[model samples]
Target chain A: MSEVIVITSGKGGVGKTTTTANVGTGLAQLNKKVVLIDTDIGLRNLDVVMGLENRIVYNLVDVVEGNCRMKQALIKDKRYPNLSLLPSAQTRDKTAVSPEQMIKVIEELKEEYDYILLDCPAGIEQGFKNAIAGADRALVVTTPEVSAIRDADRIIGLLGANELKKVELIVNRLRMDMVKRGDMMNINDVTDILAIDLIGAVPDDEQIVISTNQGEPLVGSDCLAGKAFENICHRILGEDVPFLDLEIKTSIWDKIKEIFKKN
Target chain B: MSLMDLFKKKNSGDIAKDRLKLVLISDRANCSPDVMEMIKNDIIQVISKYMEIDAEGLDIQITQTESEGNNGNVPALYANIPIKDMKHTGPAR
Candidate 1:
């Protein structure tokens, strides 16, 4: 059965778009037909993250406003033949599309794809409502910071109020060394407070920066963050996958560099 | 700066967990059916230690009550649990 999932974080810059992009690509790689919808209308960037920014004939606004057909708005990914993206309009404001329009768009997309991943905008506003309007479940992303956790709790309560009870948590950009040193909250510390099943915990990796810059999903690469995202895909498909055990240890290159330094 | 600090200093992770629990109490107090459910579960666990209670008939909610410090009214947790039987042992504490 096709499922609609929204990747949302009430706070900005918590890796919602990255999770949506990678998970969509990962599902497609696993032979599932997936289409990603960028719901951040005024500030659209999922297209750039998917390396399909240059080929945008129509957008979500066009499809909802009847300017173009739904098929016309879909931009197919050549890398993964089963994956597609419907980019948001950069010029239109968030009010341009209502929650009903978003539900309508998702309903039509559901018949053609196995997975429909919506990249939600930051904050609890119209954009957030539009993203979660037709979602069967939600993935709340947060870092191990006080502000992020507070916002995540608020978002969870809001989701519950909306009668959307199937919510899961994703702790992103967790530094294992800091966690071991008692400087940062570990995964358990987060999940206990949030009181939700953890989808995945992505580590703070420089490779993620590179992947985002190249406008590509890191799920295909042999990186730690990519592997965490792949496990998330398996868990989304109802497969039992264990969380990554990121032990605190310096890289061998760091060890070699320390040996060469003389005080 | 020294090894002694490692033994004395509180782990920030623990501190964050404590702070989150307190902060969420207020955040979830507003229109939270989940918060009420969480409180209900907590009440059941704690009261279960003293006696056999009718779990099916338990009811809990957050309501305004008089503050102990003579301040204005504040939100309070109130629970009504029916007792089925008293445990042979005294309060677990």
Candidate 2:
């Protein structure tokens, strides 16, 4: 069965596009036909993130407005034959595509793909509404920060109000060292407030920046963040995958405690 | 300082969690403390007219509780109004 999932964070720069790209690529790597849709109409970046920016002949607006066929607008990735991207138009704003049009486009794509991932824009505006219009599930990505968690809480409430019951969470950019130092919110602290099923927890890694810059998703690599995204993909496919152990490095204080216990 | 406080200093994570707990409760309830106060006053006025109740001891709060069948947590409006006595009156007075 085909599943339409929207990857969204109510605040911007929280790795929504990155998560969509990696997870979509991860699913494709699993031999599933996947299509990633960039719904951040005016500020399109998924294409660039995927390193397919130059090949865009048509965009989402063109497909929805009947200017081009849906197949004509889908950009196939060179790395993964099963993975495709429906890039958003850079000139047009969010109002260019209505929620109904989004649903119509998704309904057609649903018949051809195994999974359709929508990269929703920030805020609960038109872009967000259109992104979730035809989605059967939602993956809310948030960082381990106060503002991000607050916005995520609001987004969860909005999704519930919109009748999207199958909602899960992805806590991204977690710094274990900071968490150990009590400077950052831990996974438990975040999930306690959000109260949603956690699909993945990606640690803050510098390799993500390099991979994203190169237009290559790090899912197939051995990087900690890449492994985390791959595990999330398996979990999304209904597999019982164990979460990555984001244990902080042992400190001198912990060593002292251990010595005392031994004594 | 207390021994517990010494062991567990108030960190940023603790502060964030506490703040989020309060904020989420209010956000889910869709009302501020002032609005809750107004609601409490209105409920007291309406209920006191019918029964002799302890107006000062009434407690009305929006709390999170488990729903039937253990579906999930839901925001519930709980009112604990103390009933002191009942007003005795003739019918159709």
- Each prediction's Cα lDDT score? 0.90, 0.92
Candidate 2 lDDT tens digits, B1-80: 88898777888878888778767887877898899999999997777777778889999887777899877877788899
Residue A237 lDDT in candidate 2 = 97
Q: Which digits, one per residue and each the tens of the lDDT, describe model 1 over residues A194-256? A: 889899999998988999899989995787898999999999999999888766237788678
Candidate 1 DockQ score? 0.57
Root-mean-square deviation of Cα positions for candidate 1 versus the true structure, in angstroms: 10.6
List iRMS (one decimal) for every candidate: 0.8, 0.8
Q: A1-263 in candidate 2: lDDT tens per residue? A: 89999999899999999999999999999999999999999999999999999999999999999999999999999989999999999999999999999999999998999999999999999999999999999999999987899899999999999999999999999999889988899998999889999999999999999998999999968878999999999999999998887773356787789899999
DockQ of each: 0.57, 0.59
Any runs in candidate 2 off by more than 4 Å, and if so which?
Answer: A248-263, B1-8, B32-93
Q: How many clashing residue pairs, candidate 1?
A: 0
With candidate 1 superimposed using the best TM-score fit, by how many Å does residue A185's alpha carbon deviate from the native? 0.3
Instruction: Give model 2's DockQ, 2 decimals.
Output: 0.59
In model 1, which runs have C-alpha deviations exceeding 4 angstroms? A248-263, B1-6, B31-93
Highest lDDT, which number?
Answer: 2
